[model samples]
Target: MTDWKKIRAEFPALENWIFLNTATFGQLPKRATEAVACHFARRDRYACSDFMGWFEDADSVRATIARLIHAAADDIAFIPNACTGLSLMMGGMDWKPGDRIVTLEDEFPNHYYYPGYLAAQGVEFIETPFERFYDAINQRTRLVALSMVNYSTGFRPPLEEISGFLRERGVMLYLDGTQGLGALQLDISAIRPAMLSVDGYKWLLAPTGGGFIYVDSELRRHLRPNIIGWRSHRDWRNHENLHHGTPEFGTEAEKYEGGMLSFGPIYGMAASVEMMLEIGPEVIDERVMQLAGSVRDILRRAGGVLRADSDSLYISPVVTARFEEKDAGVLAHELKSRKVLVAARHGNLRVSPHFYNDETDLERFEAALKQVL
Candidate 1:
C-alpha cells in the first residue's frame, strides 16, 4: 500500500497549507531540496573540477526519465523548459507556404505560439474547438500539437485516439504533458507521439527550469539541432583539441542538449524522480484519482457544476467546479482563508490534489467549501 502520510512528511510545504494547486506548481519534496544543496556544496569544493561527472549525472537523469516514459535512454534530452522543446520541434521541421498545423484554442501559450511562430515561415495555424480537435486534421496538416490535459479545466485528451489518427495521415503529434506527467500514468509507447515535453515544476514536483523532451528514435534523425553549443558535440570534453576540426554531431537525442548543464536543478529533479518511482506510478495514480474523485463528488453534492467529464476516471488529479451563485474567484479566496488552497480558473474552482493529500485533507477542503458556498 502507498503510505501517503509518509510521503506528505517528505514535503514540508504540505504541513502548512492545503496545497491543491499541483497543476500550477508542485511542492518539492525535502529529499530533492537536500540533493540540490548537496550538489551546490560539491560544486563549491572544486570550482574548476572536471565537469564530466556532471555530464554523467545528466545522462543518468535522462535514463530515469526514459524509464518513467518507457522510452529508450538515447531518445530523451534535457531542456530547460517545455517551450524550448516545442520550439525545437517546430523549428526543425520543414514547412512550406499554406501548410497547416492543428491545435486547440485554450492550450498554454508556449505550446500555441510556437506553431504560430512556424506560421511566420509561411505555415498556417488552425485552431479547432477542443471538443472537436480531431475533426480538424486533414491532408494539408503537417503537425498536431496539444496539451495532454487542459491546464485550466483539467480536461484529459484522448491521446491514444489522436495519435492513431495523426499517424495514419503521416502528421506528427507533439504532446505537452506538464499537467499530467507525475499525477497520471501515461504509456508513451502506446501513445507513440513524435515528441512529448514535460516540465518538472508542476506535476513532477521538482524545481522550475527542470524539464525533458522525448523524441521517437525514428524521428530523431529528422530533427536538426536548433541551438548550437560546444557541449552538443559527441566529444565535447576534449579541451586539448582546441584547434581540432568541427566536432561530430551527437549520435542520438543528445544533439538537442545545448550549453552547459544545470547540475543543481538536474540533481534535484533526479531525486524527485527517484522518490516518485519508489512510490510506484501506479499506486500514486490510484491514490490521487481516488482523492480527486471523492472531492468531485463532494462538490457535485454541494450543487457545484463540474466542467470536466463526470464519467472519465483518467482525468488528472486536478478537479474544477463552478458554484451556481458565487464568484469562483471569491470562493477561492474564501477557501484560502480557511487554510485550503485551490485556484480559480475560467470561472471554476480548480482543486488539484496530489499523492500526499489524504481523505482528511479532502474533508477539510469540503468543510471549507461548505462554509464558502
Candidate 2:
C-alpha cells in the first residue's frame, strides 16, 4: 500500500500550489533537486578528478531507465529531448522516393517537422484525422508515427490494436509517450513499437533535458546513426586513436546517442526514477486514475463537456472539461488566481493530477471551478 502522505512529503512544491499540470511539466521532488545540487558541488570540488565516475553515473541512469521501460539496458539511449529522438528515428530510416509516413492531425510539431525533413528526401507526409488513423495505413506507408495520448484532448489511443494491425502489414510503428509515461502503466514488450521516445520532465518528475529513446533490438540493425559522437562508440576512452576511423558502431541502440551526455540532468533523473521504483508504477497508475476519475465524475455532475468519451478506459491521467457559456481561458485564469494551476489547451481546461495529489486538492479545484463558473 503506497501512502499518499509519505509520497506528498517527497515533493515540497505541492505545499505551495494545487499543481494540476503534470501534463505540462511535473514538479521535481526535493531529493531530485538535492541530487543535482550535490553533483554541481562535486564538480566545484575537483573539476576533472572524477571524470570516469560521471560516465558511470550516466550508465547507471540508462540502466534505471531501461528497467522502467522493460527494455534491455543496451537498447536505450539518452537524448536531449523528445525531438532529438524523433529526428534520429525519422532521419535514420532509408525512405525511398514516394514512401508514405502517416501521422494524426493536431500532432506535435516534431511529428510533422521530422517527417517534413524527410520529405526533402522525396518521402511523402500524410496527415489523417484521429478517427481514421487505422484506415490510413496502406502498402505505400513505411511508418506510422503518433502520440499515445493526444496532448490537446487527452485522448489515449488503442496502441495494442494499432501496433498489431501495423505489424501484420510489415509497417514500422513509432510512439511519442510524453503524455502517459509515469501517469499510465505500459509494457513496452507487449506493444513492441519499432521506436518509442518520452520526455521525463513532463510526467516522470525529472528536470528538463532528461528524456530517452527506446529502439527495438531487431530495428536497431536497420537504423543508421544520424548524429555520431565519441560517446556513441563502445570504447570512448580511445579517442586518441581516431585515425583508425570512426570507432566501430555499437551493436545496440546506444549508437544513436550523440556527443557528450549531460550529467546534471542524469543525476536529477536518477533520483526521480528511484522514487518511482520505490512506489511502483502499478500503484502510481491506480492512484492517478482514481484521482482523475473523481475529477471526471465531478465535472460530469456539473454538466461540462468532456472531449474524451466517458467509456474510454485508456484516457490519459490528464482530463479536460469544456464550459458551455463561460470562456475556458477565463476559467483557467480564475482557477490560477485561486492557487489552483490548470492549463487551457484547445478551449478546455486540462487538469492533470499526480500521485501526490489527494482529495483535498480535488475539492479545492472543484470549489474554485464553482466560484469561477
Candidate 3:
C-alpha cells in the first residue's frame, strides 16, 4: 500500500503553495535536491577522479529509465533535451530530397518546426489537423513526428494505434514523450515508436537540462551519428588516439551522446526516478488520473469549460479548462496570486497535478477559481 500523505511530505515545495505546474516544470523532491548536493560535494572533493563514478551512476540511471518505460537500457541515450535528441536524429541522419514527414497541426514547436527546417532541403512537410494526423501518412511519408500528449491541450493521441498504422506503411514514428513519461504508464512494447525522446525536468521530477532519447535497436544501425565526440568511440579512453581526427564510433545509441553529460541534473534524475520507481508507475498513474479527474470535475462545477478531452483510454494527469468570459492569462494570474499555480496555453488554463497533490489542493484551486473567475 502507498502512504500518499508521507509521499507528499517528501516535496517541501507543497508546503508554501499549491503547485499545479508540472506541465511546465515539476517540483523536485528532497531526495532529488539531496542527490544533486551529494554529487556536487563529491565533485568538489575528488574533482576529475569521480568521473568514472559519474559514468557508473549514469548507467544505473539509464537502466532505471529504461525500466520505467519498459525499454532496454542499451537502446537509451542521454541527451540534453527532447529537442536536441529530435534535432540530432532529423538533422544528423540522411534524408532523400523527396522524403515526406507528417505531423499534427497542434504539435509543439520542436515537432512542428524541426520537420519544416527539412523543407528547405526538398523534404515534403505535411501537417494535418489533429484528428486527421494518422491519415496524413502515405507511401512517401518517411517519418511521422508527434507528441505523446499535446502540450497545449493535453490531448493524448492513441500511440499504439498510430504506431501500428505507421508500421504497416513502413514509416517511422517519432514521439516526444516529455508531457507524459513520468506521470503516466508508458509500455514501449505496446507502442514501439522508431524513435522517442523525453525531457526529464517536466515529468520525471528532475532538474532542468537533463533528458534521454531512445532509438529502436534496428533503427540505430541505420542512423549515422553527426554529433561525434571522444566519448562516442568504443576505445574512448585510448589517450594515443585522443588527438587523432579519425576515430571509430560505437555501434549503439551511445554514439549520439556527443560529449560528457550534464552530471548535476543526471544525479537528480537518478534519485527522483528511483523515488518514482519505489512508488511505482501504476500507483502514480492512478493517483494522477484521479486527482486530474477531480480537478476537472471541480473546475466544471466552478463554471470552467473543460477544454481537454477526457478520453477514457488516453486521459492523462493534465487537465485544461477555459472560462466562458475570463481570459486565460488573467485567470492564471489570479490563481498565482492565490498560490494556486497553473499554466495558460493557447487561451486555456492548464492544470497538471502530480502525486504530491491532495484533495485540499483541489479544494483550494476550486475556491480560487470561484473567487477569481
Candidate 4:
C-alpha cells in the first residue's frame, strides 16, 4: 500500500499553501531539490574530471523518460525546452510552397510561433478550433502539431483518434506533451505520434531547462538533426579527425544533444522520474482524479461551470471552473489571499492537482471558493 500522506509531506510548498498550479510549474519535492544541490556540490569539486559520469547520469534520465512513456531510450533526446524540440521537427522537415500544417489557435505559443514563422516560406499554417482540427486536414497538409493536454483549459485532445485519421493520409503528428506526461497515464504505443516533446518543468516536476523529445522509429529514418555539435558523434574523443567530408552523427536522437548540459537539472530530472516510477502512474492518476472530482462537485453545487465534462475520458488531472458571478482573476486573487493556490486561464480558474495533493488541500480550496463566491 502507498503511503500517500507521507508522499504529500515531501513537497514543502504544500505546508504553506494549497498548491493547484502544477499546470504552470510543479512544486519540486525534497528529493528533487536535494539531488540538484548534490550535483552542484559535486560539480564544484570535479568539473571536467567527472564529465563522463555526468553524461552517464543524463543518459540514465533519458532511459527513465523512455520507461515513463514506453519508448526506446535511443528515441529520446534531451532538449533545452519544448520549443527547441518543436523547432527540431520543423527544421528537419523539407517544406514546399503549398504544404500545410494544422494546429490549434488556443494551443500554447510554442506550438504556434515556430510553425507560424514558416509562413514566410509559403507554408500554409492553418490555426483552427480544437473541434475542427480533423476537418482541417487535407492532402496538402503534411504535418499537424498539437498539445497533448492544453495548458489553459486542461483539455486533453483525442490524439489516438486524430493520429488514426492522419495515418490513413500519411500526415505526420507532432505533440507537445508537457502538460500531460507526469500527471496523467500515457501509453505511446496506443497514442502513437511521429514525435512527442516535453518541457519537464511543468508536469514532470523537474527543474527548468530539462526536457526531452521522442521520435518514433519510423520517423527517425526520414529526419536528421538540424544542428550538430561535438557531442553528436559516437566517439567524443576524436579531436584529430574532425571531419573528412560529411561528419557521421549518431544514428539515434542523441545526435541532437548540444554541448555540455547542466548537471543539476539533468540529475534532478532523473531523481523525480525515478520517484514517479516508484509511486506508479496509476496510483497518481487515481489520487489526482479523486481530488479533481471532489472540487468539480463542490464548485458545481455552488453554481460554477465545469470547463470539462466530468464523465469524459479526456478529463485529465486539471479542472477548470468558472463561477457564475465571479471574475476568474478576482476569484484567483481571493483564493490566494485565503492561502489557496490556482491559476486563472481563459475565463476559468484552472485547478491542477498533483499526486502529492490530498483532500485537505481540496477542502481549503473549497472554503476559499465559498468565501470568494
Candidate 5:
C-alpha cells in the first residue's frame, strides 16, 4: 500500500489551506516548481547556451505523456492548453455544410465555442443531456464531443459503451480529459477515440499553458494539418542551421504545434507527471474516489442540502452537492474566507480532492461546510 501521508507532503500549498478544488486548478508539487525554477536559474546564469537541452526536455516529456495515455509519442502533440488542442483538431477536420456535431449540455466552453463557429458553416450543433446524447447520434452526426467526466455534476460517461457504439457507426469521438486524465485511468486501447485533449494544470499537478492532444491515425484522411510553422515539419531540426522551404508536415499529431514551446513549463510538467507515475495512477484514482465518496456521505449526514438531482451510476472524483436555500457563490466565498477552498459551478458546489488531500482536509471541510450551511 502507498503511504498517502507521504504523498500529501509533496504539496506544500496544502499546509495552510483546505484545498479541495482540483476541478478549477491543482496545487503544483514542490518538485515541479523547483524544476521550473531550476530551468530559469540556468537561464539566468547562461543565455540560450543550452538550446538543445530544451528540445530534449520537450521530446522526453512527449514520451512521458504517451506512457500516461498509452499512445505513441509521435501521435502526441504538445499544446498550449486543452482548448487550443481541441481547436487545432477541430480546425483540421474536413467539415462539410451538413456535418453534425453532438456534445453534452454543460461542457467547458471549448465544446461549444469551436462547434458554434462550425454552426455558421451550416454544421448542426446539438447540445443535449447525457441521457439522450446517444439517441442524438444519427447518420448525419460527424463527431461526438464530450468530457470524460462532467465538470458541473461530476458524472462520468460510459466511454466503453459510447466508444464501441461510435466505432460500429464509423463516427468520431472527441474527448476532453481535463477533469479525468490524471485522476482516472484512461487507456487509449479501450476507448480508441479519434482525438483526446487534456490540460496539464488540473489533476496533472502542473503549471498553466501546457497540455497535449492525441490524434488517431484513422482520422488522418479526414483531419488534415490545418496549422503549421517551422517546428511543425518533420524535418524541423534547427540547431546549427535553419532549414526552410516548402516544408513537409507529417500526419502525426505534432503537425498542429504552430510555434516554439515554453520549456520551463515543459520541465515542470515532466517533473509533475514523473511524480504521478511513481505514485501509480490506479493508486491515485482509488484514493481520490475514496475521499470524494467520504465527502458525499458527510454532505448527506449534515442535512440542509437539496437535491438539484444526481446520477450515481458513473461517477468521478468530482463531488457536487446542492443547497437550495444557499447561493453557491456566497457559500464558496464563505468557505474560502475560512481557509477552506472549493468551487461553485453552474449554481452547484463542486469539490474535488486529489491524492495529496488527507482525511484531516475532509474533516476541516466538513466542519467549514456545516458552519456555512
Candidate 6:
C-alpha cells in the first residue's frame, strides 16, 4: 500500500487545478520546496562560509541521481538545464568535417539548434521520423540525438531496440531524457548511452534551473570539453601553492562541473528525486500508465482523436488528443478557464499524468473536456 492519496496531498496545487500537464511543468512537491528553502536559509546565514558543504550536498545529490539511473556517481554532473547539458556534451565532442548527426523530426528545438549550429562547421544534421530513425542512419552518422519519449505525442520510441542497433555499429547514442526519465522506468546502465541529459523541472517534480548530465566513463577518458575553468582541475584549491605546474583534471564527468552550482535547485531536485525513489519506479510507471489509459478512454468517448495508437508497444505518461474541429491551443485555453491544466504541443492537447494523480483528477478532466466539446 503506497498511500497514493497521501502522496498526492504533498502537492497542494492539485486542490486548485486538475493538473495534467506534467510535460510542460510538474508541480513542485512540498518536500522539494522545503529543501530549496533550507538551502536559501543556509546561504542567507553564511554568505561565503561552509563552501565545501554546498559541494558536498551537490556530490550527495549526484550520487542519488546515479543510484536512480544505476550509474556511477562519477558519471553524473549537475547542470543549469537540459539545454546547456546537450550543448556542453555535443559542443565538446571532437566532430570532424562531414560527420552526420541523426535526430528526430519535431523535437523540442534543443535537439535542433546544436546540430544546426554545427552545420556551419561542415557537420551534417539529419532529422527523421522516429519510426524511420533506424533506416536513416548511414555510415556518416556519428551520434544519434533523440528524446526517450516524444513530448508532443507521448510517443515513447523503441529506445532499447535502437540502442542495440547503434551499439552494433559503434554509433554514439545521445538522449534527452527530460520527458521520460522520472515519470517512466528506464535503466540507463542497461541502455549504456554515450550521453543522457535531463532537466528536473518536468516529470522529476523539482524547481527550475537544475538538472544532471551523464557521460560515459570511456567517453570521458577521451573527450575534452570545450569549456573548462579553475574547477576543471582536480586540485583547484591548490591555486595558492608556491609552485604548480600542469593541472590534472578529473577523469570523471565531474570535470565538466566547471564552476559554482546553485545549491538550492540541487537540493530541490534531490528532494523530489528521493520522493520518486521512495514511491518506487515500477510502481510509479504502473500508476502513470493506468491513468494515461483512462485519459485515452475519456478522450475516445469525447470524440477526440488520439495522436498515437493507444495499443502501441511504446507509450508514455503523456497522452495527446484533439477534437476533430477544435484547435489544440483553443481547447487548452478552454480547459484552463475551467481550472483544468493541459498543454498544446504540435497541435495536440497533451496531458501527462503522474503517480500522484488519481481518478478524481481524471474524472474532473473528463467532465470538463466533455462540456467543452
Tell me the alpha-carbon RMSD of every candidate: 1.7, 1.6, 1.6, 1.8, 1.7, 1.7
For model 1, how does the per-residue alpha-carbon lDDT over 176-266 read when each residue is reduced to its tens digit?
9888899888889999999999888988988887888898887887778778787677777675663256656766787888677777888
lDDT for each candidate structure: 0.83, 0.85, 0.86, 0.83, 0.84, 0.86
**Residue pairs in steric clash, candidate 3?**
none
Error of 4 at 112 (Å): 1.7
User: Ten residues in a row with the worst lDDT in model 3?
Assistant: 307-316
- In model 5, the worst 10-residue window by lDDT is 304-313
Q: What is candidate 3's CA lDDT for residue 285?
A: 92
Minimal lDDT window, size 10, model 2: 237-246
Q: Model 2, 219-267: lDDT tens per residue?
A: 8888989898776677775656643456577787878886777777888
Write down the TM-score for model 2.
0.96
Backbone collisions counted per model: 0, 0, 0, 0, 0, 0
Residue range 1-373, candidate 4, lDDT tens digits: 9999898888898889888889889988899999999988887888657767777777788889999999888889888789888888999889999999999878888877887789889999999987688899999999999998888876778888988999999999999999978878888888789999998898899999878899988887778778777776667646466544455776678777746676787778888889999999887778778877887777787788886655373477778878767899998898888888889988888888888888878877778787888
Off by over 4 Å in 3: 239-243, 308-314
TM-score of 6: 0.96
Give the per-residue lDDT digits (tens) of candidate 5, residues 1-373: 7988787788999999999999999999889999999999998888878877777778789899889888888778877688887777788877888899999888878899999998878999999987898899999998989898888878788899999999899889999999988898889878999989888899888899778888888775457676667776677766456566766776667777867888887888889899889988888888888988888877777663523234564356887877778888899999999999999998878888988898999999999988998
- Clashing residue pairs, backbone N/CA/C < 3 A, model 6: none
TM-score of each: 0.95, 0.96, 0.96, 0.95, 0.96, 0.96
lDDT of 2 at 185: 79
lDDT of 6 by residue, 256-364 (tens): 8777777788999999999999999888888889999998888888888886554484356888887778888988999999999998987888889888789999999
lDDT of 6: 0.86
